[model samples]
Target: MTTTRHPDARPSVSDPTGPPGAGRRVVAELLDLALLALPLTVGALLVDTLADADGGGQTDRVVFGGTAVLIALGILVWNRGHREGHTGASLGKHWTGLITRDRDTGHPVGTRRALLRRGTDVVTTRTAAHDHFTPLPPDTGVAALRRRRLLGLAALTVLLMLVLLASVAVGARPMSFAEVYHALIVNDGAETDIIVHSLRIPRTLLALLVGIALGVAGALIQGHTRNPLADAGLLGINAGAAFLVVLSIYLFGLSTPAQYLWFAFAGALTASVVVFGFASIGGGKSNPLSLALAGAAVAFFLQAMTQTIVLLDQTSLDGYRFWVVGSVAGRGMEVLWQVLPFLLAGTVVALASTPALNVLSLGEDVARSLGTNIVATRVVGIAALTVLTGAATAACGPIAFVGLIVPHIARAVTGPDYRWLVPYAGLLGGVLLVLADVVGRIVVRPGELQVGIVLALIGAPFFIALVRRRKLVSL
Candidate 1:
């Protein structure tokens, strides 16, 4: 007797490649296990080095080592056990062309069934593998997700306001909240008013503007370069600014931030132009890799010139050291006013370019396919980046890590969408720098640490933890 089946019905059983061999299974499992172990081992070694540097005791070592081990185990369980059980393929299995599927239906056994199958395999000393696969569920709720991000941005804004208040209130001569409020709103000409209005207010405002500039510039640079680690420095902004500042000090005897601001701005702008020009030379098309390489070369050359100037002239060295240390202190509102136009222009352009950036993130081929003007997008991005970085560096020196760290933090909350990412980064950058400035004040008491130094101390460990916590977000 012949079996009858409906034309619309599909095959219930399908196995394109049949079961993978025992050798393949064993190799895949070993590969997966090794992959899981590698990060933990690296993290422990790094922690050990840091501990040794800090002169940590045995207990510290034990605690850190144990934490690393536990984190590793958690990852192992997620990657090898839960993720693989749910998805039917670990990294090893995927690499080795193996998958686990139900015997009857030729589909990935749901997580529990897959775990049960593994248990059965262990008991029977047998292997189960197939080539069947299913696509993951489509992403939805984008509107809700965006709304959540908006709320997060608002929360960050509020936090930044508190930090601003703290920056104003927590200086050498600490003032109460009431004093700070009165100083700002009611000018009674008191000592608190003098301190608040004259010193702390200017410094805080400078920090806020500079932080926003650096942060937004950083996000734009990273977006353009497609490098999460990239920042304004990649375009030689810092080096060029330093070079010109040094020159101005050596040649013109300019000693103050205000005196040297124009030189620094010019140098930063020139360096970025040079970078873009060099990147666009051969094919008239600038890619991320080319831009990065060009920027590095220009930066090195400028830095060499800067160092030579500083070494030759004592005055230059002193001035350069002060500028290079990166601080918002000792800057007046006049300095902020000087950079305000460039900063505003850069910010507007940066925001305008966000839509293009989103398209470009899809890679060049795809971007071109979708009618994105790659060169134009890059030019806008670089222009915005240069202007913002130039203005900020000129105003407050190149405050390290504000640019580098803020974008990543913002991205964590805002995802890869540049529209949200840029604004979030700007606000977060302001918050972080101002907060770091406050911490610097408190940590050293009478004499405060530079914002740059504080950022380095805080940023280093935070960055390490960020890396160890999970994979960097894809640019």
Candidate 2:
């Protein structure tokens, strides 16, 4: 028997065996990486420009440039709407030529169709999700799936965009719509640039990256575990990373944020393994609910231990508070680089599992008959999840809803196909966090809400709704 796959440049629904082409995926990723890296690179260049400069000039320049990029991203996102959602996106979609089109007529696409397409995509993706990792209601109606997906997408876009725009406007030196517009486009060295760079841009970008990582990681983990509730932080990776910092402070007396890296990485990896083992322990297959429970258990256990540690040592407590609460503030390029390798590697592995996840969705007997390597698939998925969650928690100190909420958002747009779901989730995730973080910056006038806090405040209701869901679906 010969194995076949989709061409990486363009994914064909008909072809399921080929690796996704690099060009489409890579270009978009590179663009995002550049966004993350550019701020610091520019800041460094500015510092170099004025070696004899005091902190004030360097600060102003760094802040200004960073803010410009943030505004660009926000405006870019706003303009990215094809009625809604990304089209010809990722590096590969450009090369392989992927475009969102009218589902039925299959024409060049208009805003209404794009919106409808997004609506369907989310339904298909989420409904399929119901069947794959966790079971939806017995004989869950197609119509229900469609509605959920549409509602999810609508909720996300409305919330994310409003928050982002408001955040941009809300700042220490508040600017009217005109000034903000001038800073974003004209870019004549003014206080407007400072507003754009220092607060709005960098924070938004950081939130974007963090959200993307978390959203993709959530999809991977959820798809892998088959548990709708499974989140990157829920799996104990967040606590592990935080605990590592706690350990470092308690033992080594480490102080700088830079010093938190190794410990965070170590913590993330360790937690993943422990959680995996817990999920897989029973003789039966590791269901999504079991995995989620395992993760929740581990997370609570670690958090309790951490709180105890904090209660004992104020120094450790001081270090842990900001990180545990989850914020995108004060995160510079250094933090981005330090955790980037893990995020990239993890995302690759997760993306790699989409085919297997698709097969798994067909159920165990079918998967085995088709030679899907269920055990191996599980291993790869778990590993991918570990790497992704580890890196994300390490980077952003356990930002939550991006992972939990973004997949649902992606599903609303792309449907339940893991193939499209994974990538779109990443984009939607980026958009979500950027909006959230941006809002955090502006909501309370300069003091900032902190991305984590904002998400929790928002995510709390969603999470509660999920928990309150009366119908428990079993596959």
Ten residues in a row with the worst lDDT in model 2?
A: 120-129
How high is the lDDT of residue 233 in model 2? 69
Per-candidate TM-scores read 0.71, 0.62
lDDT of 1 by residue, 57-160 (tens): 34334434554676677666666666666666767877786666555554545555554564322111123423325623423488867787978978787778
lDDT of 1: 0.80
Could you tell me the C-alpha RMSD of candidate 1 in Å?
10.6
lDDT of 2 by residue, 363-408 (tens): 8889999989887888888788778777767777878777887777
Q: Which regions in candidate 1 have their CA more than 4 angstroms from the true location?
A: 1-140, 465-471
lDDT of 1 at 421: 92
What C-alpha lDDT do the candidate models reach, one value each?
0.80, 0.66
- What TM-score quantifies how close candidate 1 is to the native fold? 0.71
